[model samples]
Target: MGPRPEYPRPALRRAEWQSLNGEWEFGAGDEPVFDRRIVVPFCPESELSGIGRRAGDVVWYRRWFDAPEAERLHLHFGAVDYRATVWVNDVEVARHEGGHSPFTADVTAAARTAENVLVVRAEDPLSDKTIPRGKQHWTETPEGIFYTATTGVWQSVWLEPLPALHVTRLSLVPDLRAGAVDFEVDPGTDFVVTLDGEVVGRSSGQPRGRLRLERVEPWHPDSPRLYGLEARLGQDRVETYFGLRTVEARDGRFWLNGEPFIQRLVL
Candidate 1:
């Protein structure tokens, strides 16, 4: 068997979603009141989050969503740093906390047709001195390369269908040599590709097909070009973006943007 590919970020997708990724309550020692706006997928410490102040180890995030007929529901978190506890409609529904990656919780039992309240509490020991602390700075006095810390919901929270018969994943591999992208849908299905609301490419009956597109814009620092795709399954549709580029070794050196250089890790 071949190596399984990495699942796309924001994987638990659905055509219908109430994005609770922006801002919400956040505080430690006491539950937060009122809401603050923060960008999903970016930590509070990041410029994207807007709420630049470092949150303490524990903070709560609360929001509401409405489901029409009360089908099984899935709660998705793009990436919540460290550990987190989740509640739905005032009822404890799920819990997860890790600074990297993503996770999902089945919340079918905790949802109502009207409005569902969600609460999340996150905690991290900053610098445990023992665990792999990544870029998290648990210090009140942030020093050195360490930046601020992000607690609570630092990612998008969305609802996905709890399908009775099917669940699938898709991966698009750009093959410049073939002048196309190898699109393979797990539990494979038909799909289409588009760009700027225009149908640029597509895959037919076969689950795995080549989606060819012209104007091969080599993704680079100077000229970055990307294509969009929308895959269909039953009544569900998903949007994805792909780039055409490659990395190769030349003259015992690494080249990026057709230039010989060493990548710098500022973090």
Candidate 2:
């Protein structure tokens, strides 16, 4: 009902992720007041955050959650505008600069077993030309081409538990012409690739492998079919999915699935 409640990281996923979306204490100063309740992952400019007003240059947010039992705990933020400084249980954990990319911090040392306090300080000065503002506006009122600024966290924030030596990343490249998909995993461990509960391929203690599909069901706008993918390395496991599709341009024309493509507006 609320944005599907799914793990935001689709490419690399783990089952031990907890969503930090919902209510959080919000304030507009160097020190948090804890008087306002704003929804996480929604900027104050939006109505969903319960504070549908323009945000200050320096804003603060606070959240308290029960720490999950794990050997390692990682706090992930999909995105935060401009610059953000985070603290876990009064210990400075991370400071990230950039508004468009995701960042994570290992909070295993700062978090307590029962409960943990997370604080975020977001600073987005519109006058800072060096920082990328995207479509956010600078003037007091919104105008042409410039939209309302998204100052604070505009994406998902969550915590994930991980083992000591886990599969950190995966790169999947689909080859429609060859009817196979090449993959590479971090840590260079032997991994198995499964599609829709069936084993498609396996790696031999190497970081690379290929999965050959028996039938190629190309993904398109009409039929957005996808295959469930699972990869396991030792005791670490992750689930992801992939869709095979191709697009190219030739002779000053567009092509999809090796055929001529045309755009049709629904409106």
Candidate 3:
């Protein structure tokens, strides 16, 4: 089995997808002449990679897979430390920065039917403090609060097929006081909002609207009630969930679900 062989995105999920986590050709250079194998989703500095050594500033990863049948295909990376440049079938598809955020590239134009080569080049400077390093130590060894630095692709890589006019983005903003959630669908398409498998609201030729719940269930630490949210736009559908709660700090104590609660914060 491959490492971390699970759906990378849990908040928003689709039924059909493919996991790209497994062994891949790994090397350090500008070219794609890989010299070693590494377990992906795991950084080179970790033991799981089989190459428990620093990956310097630049590293390369190469792999191949058959393209799935769909109108459009998207290549998703949960994250790649620092900067990442992707090439599909030797055609540059995406270039992204920021080590902690996820990115995707539309590979429909560059992908082939039978098989395609995917190459990724990650550039993470070991000593660049200007970039967000978080808890990673800049030195070769760990010291004090700092720990071993992680470089290159350290999260799941996957692919999913979509229609040409599929839903691109969905934003949900929970309003605890109003007992509603304001939603906005990209491209301003007709949509239906469902809560816990029940249709709660519908938008006719409108994209932004509010979905009010008949019964307000304020999420608390003890109860922790969450409402399953499903938004459908034509043939595209996405499944997600949201909790309704509120927090305030004006009372000199923590407030959760409109009640005063003591807070213990740990880092």
- By lDDT, the best candidate is 3
Please say which candidate is ahead in TM-score: 1 or 2: 2
TM-score of every candidate relative to the true structure: 0.70, 0.91, 0.93
Write model 3 residue lDDT over 12-70, tens digit each, in one string: 88888989999999999666669999999899999999999896789999999998899
lDDT computed for candidate 1: 0.64
Ranking by TM-score: 3, 2, 1
Model 2 residue 112 CA deviation (Å) reads 0.8
Candidate 2: what lDDT?
Answer: 0.83
Off by over 4 Å in 3: 190-196
lDDT of 2 by residue, 1-267 (tens): 344287799888887888889888998876676678888788998998889987788889998999888888899999998799999989999999988899999999999987688999999887888877677788647899888888888899998988888888888898878777888888777655555567666566668777687667778888886766666777788877778888999999889989898987693
Candidate 1 Cα errors over 4 Å, as ranges: 1-15, 30-55, 68-72, 90-92, 160-167, 194-202, 205-223, 252-267
Clashes of 2: 0
RMSD of 2: 2.2
Quote the lDDT for 193 in model 1.
Answer: 67
> What CA root-mean-square deviation does each model show from the true structure?
7.1, 2.2, 1.8
lDDT of each: 0.64, 0.83, 0.86
lDDT score for residue 144 of model 3: 97
**Which scores higher on TM-score, 1 or 3?**
3
